[model samples]
Each structure stands twice: as structure tokens, then as C-alpha cells.
Target: MNGKTSVVKHRFDIKLARSMFGAISFGMALTTSAFAFDPLLTHGAIPMSPAAPLFANTGSGVCVFDSMPTPLTLNEAIERALCNNPKTREAWAQVKIRAAEVGIGRAAYLPTVSAQWRGVRDETTTNVTNYPQYSSNYRNSVLRTESVTLNWVLYDFGGRAAALQNANSLLEAAQASQEAALDDAFGAVSKDFYSAQGARGAVDAQKEIVAAAQQTFDAAKARADKGVAPISDQLQAQTTLAQAQLDETKAEGELATAIGTLNGDMGMEPNTALAMPPVDAGVKPDAMFQETVDALIETAKASYPSIRAAQSQLDAAQAKVRQTRAEGLPKLQFVAEYSHNNQPTTLAVGIPQFPATGHEWYLGLQVTIPIFEGFVRNYQIREAHAQADYQHEVLREAQIKVASDVWSAYQTLQTATASLVSNEALIEISRKSYEVSGHRYEKGVGNILELLSGLQAYARARVSWIRAVNEWRSARLQLAAKIGRIPSR
Candidate 1:
């Protein structure tokens, strides 16, 4: 019987150890998981701007880039800017922050569980002073306690719901603001790209003028050597060639400056080397520009990211008002706790110490009502209402400003388009007149002054034509931005 009893006790001990091990393992798993989860993991569930992930960082503070392209296109430039620029990243970070807030809001609907464990060594020293013959007594014991508690807010009179809605609205607003930042970056990079292209075109045009001047100088020198033209003609032609060379040099410098600006816009060092393909000859204004200004303004009002952000802000503020009002009401909560303790008892001076263990469980409903707090709740509600009203005006102002921007951009585009047409004609006419004057001077039928005048006119016309082209391109992009769209590459 003793042997059988020993076997049963050993088996029971093994079972008890296994149960404790399983419980500890489960608790450890839960703890590890709680720490391992990140708020960024919730981004997928939140509303995210499409532009937020363009050329996203691959790792912490690590943006990957292979090599710069030799002949980069406009789209490539835009991508590079988006990838490397900090403005869009800042906006994207705001989206993440707001997303975390949304997680906090959703978590309010769930219960919080906490576990606690404690151990203590207790010691006591006692002396019977009233009886002179009594001796001192010393005692020591070990105590342990373990507890698990759960608290859940069952009701808050709509405060939690309103707060969650506010968070969700702000998250949406953050996403829209991110999109607006991206649009700004896109517009800026495109403008720089076009400006660089125009500068390059000016340099090429200057080079062409220089070549023409050189040819004229050579002709006049040859005529002067043969005694057909006077030395004055050769002198004048040489001066013209020198002026053209100086202008070409200036144009080259301007081109360099433009390239540096474009590189900076792409988030590169200003002195970084950059190569870009020439603007396409087939490129033209977008067909969308054909719509009336009124129609365009209406479309912009409906879709502009700024307008969307404002609308969402208004929603968030309204929700805030609701939350503030609910703060004055009562809250209801459910509370529960389970606890166990192992303690030794020594009640009297001569009493022997005895081991004791106790288990306790509690369940209760908690109600909290806010009566008054120096009228703070009332003021908070008023502040929230004021903020909501302010947001409403902000939304209206955003719409009005977007419409005005569309109108201004539309007018600028119209003017640029008309100027482009006239400049095209002017360049052609000037080119023909310059050619005729050059031929006449070569044949000794026109004076050096006449030829120089025609050459200067042609140069001016070429410069004007280039400016007109760039203006038209820029105007189109501006209008597209106002309409909350990326300019077509």
C-alpha cells in the first residue's frame, strides 16, 4: 500500500508540474506577442493615400537607389524627387501617427487584462516589556501573491464612439494632406524639369546664332580680301561674331544654373551631374484643358486633396464636439479580479507559525458620474463647438480658394497658348528675313548694319519662341495641379 501510494503521489506531482509549465508557456506567448506587434502593421486597415508609398523607404532610414539614369525623363525625375524628398515623408509620417491614434480608439472597445506576482520575506521581533522575566522572540516567514485582473468599460454614453469617429476622421484628413504634399512635390519637380529643358533650348539656339555670325564674318573677310567689300564690313562682321560668342557663353552659364536647380529639386547635391533628354516635339497641351473654366473649377472643388482634407477636418471637429459633450455624462464599467496568496500566520506571543494559502475572486460593476469640476466640462464643450464651427469655415474657404486657383491657372494657360502661336509665326518670319539680309550682304547689295539688325531680330524671336513654349508647358502643369491631377509626362 505504501509503494502504491508513493507511485500515485509521484504521478500527481508530474501532472501538476506539467500544468504549471503549460500555463507559463501560454502567458509568455501572450506577453511576447504584445510586445512584438507594431502600430505600423495597422496601416493596411486604415485609409492611406495612394501617393504615400511612392518610392517608399525599404528599411529604417534606408532609401534604395541604383544609379542615376543617363538621359532621364520627366517621369523619372518626378519619381526621384518623390523618393528622396523629406516633405512627402513628413506627411506620410503624420498618417502613421494618426493611424496609431485610431488603433488607440479601437482598443477602447476591448478589455484590459493585467497579471501581477510578488514575493516577500517577513521577519518579526517581539519583546514582553511588562514582564521582566519574559524573553525576546524572533520569527521569519516567506509570502507570495499572484493576481490577474480585467477591466472593461461597458458604456460611456457615446463618448468612446465619438472619440473613435474623431480619430477615424483625422486619419482620413492626414491621408488627404499627404496627397496634397505629394502634389506639391510633383508640381515643383516638373516645373524645374521644364525650366531646365527650356534653358538647354536657349543654349542651343544661341549656338546656332553664333554659327551664323561666324559664317557671315568669314564671307565678309573673303570679300574684303578680294577688294569687293570694304574693310569696314569685315570689321563689323567680326564685332557681330564676338557679340554672338558672348551671348552663347551667357546662355551656357544659364543652362548650368538651370541644371543645378533641377538637381536640387530632385533632392540631389546642387553640383551633381545630370543628363536629360530634350523635350519631345510631339508634346502638346492636355486635351482636358479644353473644358470651360467653370467646369474645371467645379471638378477641382470636388476632388482637390486640400478640399478633401478640409472636409475631413470638419468631420473630426464635429465628432470632437460630441465627445466633449459626452464627457459630462456618467460612465459604466465591468471589473473582475482573481488572486491567490501563500502566507504564514503567527498571531500570539507563544503561538506556533502555521502555513496558510488563500484564493479570492471578485466581480463587480463600477459606475462613475461627473457632477462638477469648476465648470470645466462646460467650457470644453464650448471649445469643441467653436473648433467645429471654425473647421466649417475652413472647409468653405478651401473650396473658394481652389476655385479661384483654377480660374487663375486657366487664364494663364489661355494667355500662354495664344502667345505660343504668335511666337511661332514671329520666329519663322524673323528667320526668313535674317537669311535674306545675310544673302544680300554677301552679294554686296545690303550694308553690315542691315544684316546685323536682321540677325538680332531673329535671335530675339528665337528666344521669345522658347520662352513661350516653356510658359505654355508650365501653365498647363499649374492648371493640372489646381485640378488635383498630375501633369501628363
Candidate 2:
């Protein structure tokens, strides 16, 4: 019985030794598998840090007061508009986009390089007829292929050249459009600036008139109270005072409206307080009419954005016609490629082998001739020609419009100048009449009605003079704009 027990223990020791060896082998296999798939060692993954900040100071912590007055000149206001106005910024961005398009078109003339990578894993099984039974064998295969190809356009029958030219012309057109927008914005700013200034002047003039009317009313009231003048005179004085108050209110409203418009144009909040810089209003109509017109036409021809934009459109359309016609011809290109390939195979059972590696290189010229496309190319060329014609018509129309605008501005300027001169003389005469009538009424030599009539005439003359000055200034600005001169900044 002791010997039987000893034999059983020996058998158990051998089985336990086998189990321990199997577990160690299994653990080693797992470690090998983990190493094979470790991305940190095999794939070399890179850890990336966060991006840095774009702005050093965001200005978010600054607080600005609403009542802080800034003395903004016309030039300063224009600069602000360019910097802050949404419309101008959008237009500027469009210019950049058009410029990039031109670059893209030009890139067509350059060669293109590209790479291709492909991997495949395939399995296969076969049946043998001699055994009359299916025999399955497991095989794992992987194929990785990479290639680099270069394609360059040798010639396109001038298609690429014409397209490049069209792109350049379109870029010019976009630039002109930007310039036109800038000019429009500047013109608007100038108009509003001058209008605001004129409104301010009108307010001052009306205040002066009000003061004069108040003085006359006080004198009439004093005389009526002393029993030297009739109660009707007192009533007339009160009416005059009421009219002056109404005039003052209207003038104040005009000033407020002008301020609002100017602030809005400057890209500021409507209620924001603005202080206007002083401008020199001593500009004289010194140049002769003929000289001015000649200079204006020359300036318009050189700098007018509309004319430049139209010319650019014409150029682009002409280029497009050439491009479309070239599409009917053959296109020539040069293509080249280089590649390396390796294939591994299993020759027999439990035997693995790798085949010889190979390298390939080739270059060739390819030509593509457009034989027929159901007359699509023909129609395209015809359409381009029509568009070219349309562009020409548009240019002609722009010329006519420019001429008409110049002529109208000239006429208006002449009329305004004459009116201003006449209004100045009338104001002088009315001021004399008012002074003489006021003195005579105080001495009881003239009637209150007569004095009031004189005052009314003087007020009318002053308002007319102010209106004339504003009209003349407006006409001059219009002439300056027509001539493509930048308004006074």
C-alpha cells in the first residue's frame, strides 16, 4: 500500500510541472503580442500641446464713457469708417477672395504631384479531386503598394493662357469695385460732414435773428406800457416773440438731426456725442469754367472707378471668348510616374519565401482632341462673344452717363454761384432797411407794422442767404465728386 501511494504522488508531480510550464508559455505569448501592437513604440505617436493665444491684449477690461468727447476731423472719421465699418470690411474681404481666385487660375500652368497607398489582405482555399474531399489551408497575406505620379500640362491650345488672363482681369475688376466703394463711402461722409456744419451755421444765424426780434419786441412792449404805443403794438410784439421761439426750436431740431446722421456715418452709436473739427469754408470758385471742365474730364477718365471697372469687365470677357474657342482644340500634357513593389509568397507547406522586388519609371506625352460634343463647345464660344459685346455696350453707357453728370453739375454750380452773389446783395439791403425802420419806430416816426415788415424782410433775406450758401457748397461738392477728386478730409 505504501509503494502504491508513492507512485500516485510521482504522477501528480509530473502533471503539475506540465501545467506550470503551460502557464508560463501562455504569459510569454501574451507579452509578445502586447509588444507587437504597442503604438507608442511601433507607430511613434506624438503628443501635442495646446495652441497659444492669438491676441496679447483683448481690450475686454477697458471701460469707456459715453460723454467722452472726441474731436474728430473729416480725415479721422474716414479712417475710422475704413477700420470699423462692416460694409467696408466685407468689401475688403471680397477683394482678397478675388485675388486668391486669380492665383488658383494661374496654378493650372504648374505640374501636380500626388501619392497613392494601398493595402490588401486575401485568403484562399482549394479542393483536391484525387482525395474526393475538401482540404482547407489557412494563409495570411498582406500587400502594401505606394506610387508617386506627376502630371503637367504641356499645352492646352491657349486655353490655360486665356483663363489666366481672364482671372487677372477679373482681379482688376474686383480692385476697381473696392475703389468705387471707398469713393462712395468717402463721398457720403463728406456730404454728411458739410451738411452738419451747414446746419450748425444755420442754427447760429437763427439765434441771431431771434435775439434781434426779442430786442424789437421788448422796445414795443415798453412803449405800449408807457401809453405811447397802442395795445395792438403789444400784441404784435408777443406774436413776434412766439415766431422767434418757433424758429429757434426748428433750428435746434435740424442741429440734432445733423449730429445723428454724422455720428451714424462715423460708425458710432447714434446718441454718441461728437465734436467736429473746424473746416476752412473760404474755398473760392476761382478756376475758369472751361478749365474746370477739362480738368474734371481728365480726372474722371483716369480715376473714375466705374469706368475702370467697365474696362476690366471688357478685358475679362474678351479673354473668356479666347478661352472658350481654345476648348475646341486638342490638349497636350506630360505625365510621369515611379513605383516600387514587393511580393511575399509561401512556396510549400511550412516554407515562406519573398519574390524579387521591382522598380518602374516612365514618362509619356498625352494628347486629348475634342472630336465632337454635340455642339456644346460651339455654343460656349458664341455665348462668350455675346458677353463681350454686352461688356462693350456697358462701357459706352458708362461714358455717356459720366458726361451727362459732369454737364449737370456744371450747370448747377453756375446757377448756385449766381444765386449766392444776388442773395448777398439782398441781405445787405435788408439789414439797412431793418436798422432804419427800427430807429424810426422807437422815435414814434414809423408805425409798428412797418417796423415789423422790415424785420420780416431782414429775416427772410438772412435765411435765403444761408440757404444759398448751403446750395453753393453742395454744388461744389457734387462737381468735385464728378471729377473724381477726393473730398476734403
Candidate 3:
């Protein structure tokens, strides 16, 4: 019984050990799997699937439209002018060139690397003599050699730094100049477009006047034929009609001239088919003189590119002076290079052969001290200082000019606004007077001469009204240009 008990105990111990070993193996397998998927695991766990891409897959396709070239709005015209005008495009190119110059200047702060190689061949003869013996001739041996080298300027007494600063300032100036050009172009185009509209409106008004005159003449002729009026009345009517026709012809010519001017401003062919926009007769000028003046001053301050350009030039000149002054100071730089050379040689009579392989490496520090350079540096510094002074004067001049322009435009706008009101009132009074005079003449209470006089006065008053309206329109556009907010289209 004791032996059976001992065997049972041994079997129980073996079963316990086997269970522990299986658990250990399972834990190791789990750890290994975790490590194997570490890249795809998050927060001590692995995802079962991949994440979706951020962008959606677009189907292959293209869109097309068939139509006549769309009519260009004012905004579109400005954009096209910027893109297509040769002068504007040239200015834009200049801006880019200056920007590249700035980059080049900035690059001076970084190290530069360069490489070079050279080869040479030579032959020579030599005579050798001992202390107490005759001289002996040695035949020349050919030598072939090659080498590579690298070099860097390292420092330039602060000249490079000053140059860089100047370049950056110039770039800024160029950008400002570009903006100024754009503003000028915008102003020019707007003025031309509005002027053309006014011209077309004037032509239409004149055509209507001509038609009215022709109808009056026809009625007068019919009355004379029926013996209801004198032949002189018909003659007077015909004379008025002829004058009206002449006026219409003049108006047509003026319209054509205005259109031509617009085409030139837009950089388009003079004969290009252009449709003039109808005038907005309902537009009223309501801003007070002081308010308009204040707005214009503000606009000039912020948007006048010429002023900004002058300021930029001033800044650049100052930078140049600073740079040149720096040139008179000391400079330091670090440099290093490695090279190898291989040469082949043949033995000559009684001459020993030399090894043909060579290698070399070097590291160095370079320093430059600016000494007297025949007063060249002095002259350069003086010139830069003068240029800086000149730029300041230019800036001052530009500011003054812009102020004058703004004030002039403001006054013109005010005058035009007032004139429009007066002209409109005069036109109304003249129309009433002419209508009364016509009724009196028709009833034979007023003479034909009085009727003709009233008609002429009425025509003159209408022409004045038209002229005033045009002036007002032009003045408003001028104000808009000064304020840099030409209405889009």
C-alpha cells in the first residue's frame, strides 16, 4: 500500500509540471504576436483593418462649353489688362527679376562650393657634374600631371552683407512700382470706358433731336403747301433740320473717336467690335465735398503705388549706404579642400624613376582687412550717401504731388456736382418756356421769329444739360479712381 501511494504522488507532480509548461508557452506566443504587429498596433492593440484614404477617387472626365467669348466686365478687363498688357507684363517681369535678386543676395550668407581640374606635360634636359670630373648630359623625360582644386571667397569686409541689404530693398521697391503701374492702368481704363459711354449717350440724344426737327420741318412744309402757313416758315424749319443733321454727324464722329480712345487704352485693335455700356442716368452724386476729399486723401495714403515705390527706393538707398560702410570693416571665413593627383613618367639615361601618385588635404581660415584702395572706397561711400539723399527728396516730391492731385480732383468733383444740379434746373425751365412759346406761335399770338428763338434756346438748354450730365459722370469716375474703388463692370 505504501508503494502504490508513492507512485500516485509522483504522477500528480508530473501532471502539475506539464500544465505550467503549457501556460508559459501560450504567454510567449501572445507576446511574440504583439511585437510582430507593433507598427499597426495602437494603445497596445492591433486593428483588424486598414484606415480609409483622405481623398475620394474622382472619375475621369472633362467639361466643355460652347459660346461666343463672354462680354468682359470691368473686373475682367482689369484682370485681362494685368495679364495681357505688354507694359504691365513687362513691369511684372521686372518685379520677378528683382525678387530673384533678393534671393541671390540672401544666398551670400551661405557657403558656396566649386571644382576645377588642370593638366600639364613637360620635358627637360639637365647637365650634372662631380667635384673633379667631366660633366654628363641627362636625357629629358616626359612628365604628365593632373590635379583638382576648390576655392571660396569666404569674406569681403562686409561688402556682401551691404549688397544683400540693398538688393532686398530694391526688390521691395520693384513690387511697389508694379502696384503703382496697376493702379494707373486701372484709372486709365475706367476713365476711357466711362467717357465712351457718355459719348454714345450724347450721340443717341442728338439723334432724337434730329428726328424731332425733321418731323417739325415736314409739318411746316405741309402747312405751306395747303396755304395755311408762309413759305418762310417752311424755309426756317428746313434750316433747323439741316443744322440738326449736321449736329448728328458731329456726334457720330465724336462717338467714333471716343471708341478709338477706349480701344487704345485697352491695348486692343482700333477696329475691334466693342459694345459700349448704357449710361446709368439714374445715378445721383450725393457725397459731400468734405467727405469726398477725406476719402480721397485716405485712398492716396494707402493705395498710391508711386508713393510707396518712392519710399521703397529710399529704403534701398539707405541699405546701400549701410552696406558700403560695412565694406570698410574686417571679415572672417572658413574653408577646406581635398585633392589627388596622378602622374606617369619614364626613366631617362642614368636617371632614377620617381613615384607618380600624390594626395593632399587642407583646412584654413581667411581674414580680410580693408586698407586704402586709392580712395575708391571713399568715393563709393560718398556716392551711396548722395543717392540716399536723392531718394529722400524723391519721396518728398512724390508725397507733395499726390496731395496736389487729390485736392484738385476733389475740387473738380464738387464743381461738377453743383453744375449738374444747376443745369438740370435750367433744362426744366427752358422746356416749359419753349412749350409756351410754341403754343403762342401756333395760335398766331407770337411771331415765327419768337418761335424760332425759343426753339434755339431750348436746343441750347438741352445741350447744356447733356454736357453737365457727362461732366458729372466723368467727375464721379475720377473720384472713384482716386479712391481706388472703380465700380466693377
Using TM-score, give the best candidate's number: 1
Cα lDDT tens digits, model 3, 433-477, are: 878877786665866567667667777777777667767766776
What ranking emerges by TM-score with the best candidate at the front? Answer: 1, 2, 3
lDDT of each: 0.81, 0.70, 0.65
lDDT, residue 3, model 2: 18
Clashing pairs in 3: 162-323
Report the lDDT tens digits of candidate 2 across residue range 37-144. 542231221111000010113243212224434555555655455444565556556565666667667678889998765545434444344432333343445555
All candidates' TM-scores?
Answer: 0.87, 0.77, 0.75
Q: Which residue pairs in candidate 2 have backbone atoms (N, alpha carbon, C) closer than 3 angstroms, thus clashing? A: none
TM-score of 3: 0.75
Ten contiguous residues with the weakest lDDT in model 3 = 46-55
- Candidate 1 residues lying further than 4 Å off, grouped into runs, are 1-41, 45-66, 126-128, 131-141, 280-282, 349-352
Assess the local accuracy of residue 87 in candidate 1 as a C-alpha lDDT between 0 and 100. 86
Query: What is the RMSD of candidate 3?
Result: 22.5
Q: Which has the higher TM-score value, candidate number 1 or candidate number 2?
A: 1
